[model samples]
Target: MSDIEMIRAARARIAGNLRRTPLLSAPALDAIAGRRVLLKAECLQVTGSFKARGGWSAVSAIAPEVRARGVIAFSSGNHAQGVAHAAREHGVPAVILMPQDAPKAKIDGTRALGAEVVLFDRERDDRDAMGAALAEERGLTLIKPFDDALVVAGQGTLGLELAEQANEHGVTSAEVLVCCGGGGLSSGVALALEAEAPGLRVRTCEPEGFDDVARSLAAGEIRRNDRLSGSICDAIVTPQPGNLTFPILRRLCGPGLAVSEDEVLRAMALAFRHLRVVIEPGGAVSLAAALFRPEALTGETAIAVATGGNVDAALYARALSTLE
Candidate 1:
């Protein structure tokens, strides 16, 4: 089977594990974007993020012997908790490698799910390298956060839910918005929508500091950002777009837009006030594009992926304190 086929198969195998999260129109955002807006509330998903979809998909795909060895993963936060939660359900142990600078709430949340957490430095070493080494040393099945095909397909299931939700709610031809990191969630989602709901235009939103996906698409090659600065959207600190994911995004998604730290923080507060959902800065960036970059998406219905609810309470409070 092709990569897309494999992804589809993975989705089929893991269909029983995920939630069909709500996709609802935000009347408030309609007034802001000047277009009807919908939010896919994946933050309310099982692991408090959309990462659970990919985690469970990859976990359940393993053969009995492979799964018997247990699993290990590396994530900034969301995927760590995702692996922990999925492994718990599958009766296996999960180990997660996270950057030392990751939010305390994310560290605590991953640990709370009973996964062993190991902290490292993004400046010194990559999580993929560290995770691969650990997985090899311990003979554990490794699940990548955003680069694996199974993981990508699993993340695509969110699109399945969105399409179903859109049909159910009588909203079609809307834009499906996702916050871009390594491109796992959006790639999978775009593919799913392409296959299932061709009318939907899948789009990506990212922090200005970590705009590799958008930049790479423009340059037609992978471009790395040597310095990442001023992003409240910490979950989206990817230095470069994944090779497999970049091509997918290039072909499957429409023009990806970026926003500032101020924009993301403001959007985060807006979601909290209007949707009554806790969206981390990264997740809120998609909505930020919808709100602040409305001219880029005029006349089209928009949907923002509320990718995760996991926020650093201290950070959130700080952001809120500065609100005007």
Candidate 2:
């Protein structure tokens, strides 16, 4: 179990660097969900995503000697930028392995933060194995995107902020919908909510067909996705949940919800038009579930964490055109 102390330490360590993203209220979203809807706009966070929280936590916690050799990480987009930005802040070199087809915006963003970018063929290459080998060869510390304790703890800081903000609004019992990839964010939030607001329910939302966490929780075992590169929600398309994160999620989170790509596009369009936020498909899944899956939500207060805003302009325009 993840203790609140770990999250407290993580918060303290990364507080100065990370943006304390606001909890925003949207009347249009509330009307669609038939509930009081609040958005944890993590899209507005540093690196345009919440992954920076974990990246800073992990990198800063490294032993000074190890950090001197620098760090390496594997991510689709958001985590790449997170690690790169964190490494830059620590004055360390970072090598990031990303999918060759990952959104151009994310790749450019990571490079702009001064990390060396290595592109891999997503369909043919094993990112984990490649990242491990590269780390070993360079004698660099590997930042396991979700599996590391420090990373999970860092991600949990979002939960701390959300819980406190929700309580400030007089929300006693609410349901938090999180976008699930390797269960890092979902499980981290679950652990924090468990300690901060026991009354709140944590639910995960994933892209359909990539809903490994949902099936794993249902079967009480770790599950793997059948394919790796099918979804538009590329940010959350991990083969399976992290070993460390799954247990926390299984114990603390409610049943998972899966949304289709079409639903995700619709949600992204709605976000652009009403919220004035540019949301990637992966980041829109939780909001999609909140808008479309009312039965899974537990309370009148539905708070969805919009995880990223790294969509390419062409893709964003195409998705918006679907609204017509």
> What are the root-mean-square deviations of the candidates from the true structure over C-alphas?
1.9, 1.1
* Predicted structure 2, TM vs. truth: 0.97
Q: Provide the TM-score for each candidate, comma-separated.
A: 0.94, 0.97
What TM-score does structure 1 among the candidates reach?
0.94
Task: Give the clashing residue pairs of candidate 1, or none.
Answer: none
Q: Best lDDT goes to which candidate? A: 2
Error of 2 at 168 (Å): 1.3
Worst 10 residues of 2 by lDDT: 1-10
What's the distance in Å from true for residue 301, model 1?
0.7
Residue-wise C-alpha lDDT for candidate 2, range 1-324, written one tens digit per residue: 456798889999997788999888778888998898888999999999999999999999999889989899999889999999999999999999999989999999999999999999988888779988989888889988888888999999999998899899999798899999898888888889888888788898999999999999899999999998878898999989999999998889889899999989999998888888888999999999999888777778888899999999998998899779
Q: Write the per-residue lDDT of candidate 1 for residues 185-215, one digit (tens) a residue.
A: 8888888888778888878888886888888
Q: lDDT for every model?
A: 0.83, 0.90
On the 0 to 100 scale, the lDDT of residue 2 in model 2 is: 51
lDDT of prediction 2: 0.90
lDDT of residue 257 for candidate 2: 92
Give candidate 1 regions above 4 Å deviation.
1-8, 126-129, 228-230, 322-324
